[model samples]
Target: MYKDDGFDLVFSYTFPKCDLDGSYQAVQENSTHKICVDKEGSVLTAVDKIENKTLADAMDCNCLRANLIITSVEKPTCEVNGNYSPIQCRRGTCRCVDNNGNQVCKSSVCEVAEIDRDTLKC
Candidate 1:
């Protein structure tokens, strides 16, 4: 069931367990909505809706499959020079540093490479 905040209207429906979760905000008096499907506790993708479209139409129409396909084409940003590379390497007490002063990065640890002649790098 859906309820309108400003109006005293209530909408009821019956369907499978699929649920949409996201945020909506009014920008300059215009409504902007983002809706996503929670697939097994993970958000597969946020389906973008056209202006002034109903929520049911947004999901049932062809947009859902198109959005999923586009998202699937994107690869994880794991390249050394990428923005999130440092945080990804931090799990091993390592940081991505320039290799030969170039943009390429190699793992470099902050502490000494040896501790009592045993490697203590995380």
Candidate 2:
């Protein structure tokens, strides 16, 4: 409704903002990547493999831009630069993840005894 109310309303059906540079869109459930899209949410960039000369970077639903581990994006605590936090806690277990969100350092999942500890060691 930001447009003018005129006879052009019946002639054009597209939004200008959604047509240029595309619009930021949400990915499917359980998916780690968000995408830029058209008005109807069709992928507009070549980021599937991230090998093209076009756009390559993507932000996960968890606000993570570097790590894209399967089943790990959900309920994640991310760093300010979109890297996965070094330590994460969930389901009474805590673990360590690398910059790419992969479990690393040969560390085993640690069981948390106190629920009030914000910082966890793995």
Top model by TM-score, which number?
Answer: 2
Over the stretch 15-118, how does candidate 1's per-residue lDDT look in tens digits?
22433443221111113333333233233333334553453232321232233334555322232111122222222233332311122334344333222213
State the lDDT of candidate 2 residue by residue for 9-108, as single tens digits: 4454433233245643333211233243333555432233233212224333233422333466346676432435667666765667665565666533
> What CA RMSD would you report for each candidate?
15.8, 12.6
lDDT of each: 0.30, 0.44
* Best candidate (score: lDDT): 2
What TM-score does candidate 1 reach?
0.18
How much lDDT does candidate 2 score? 0.44
Number of clashing pairs, model 2?
0
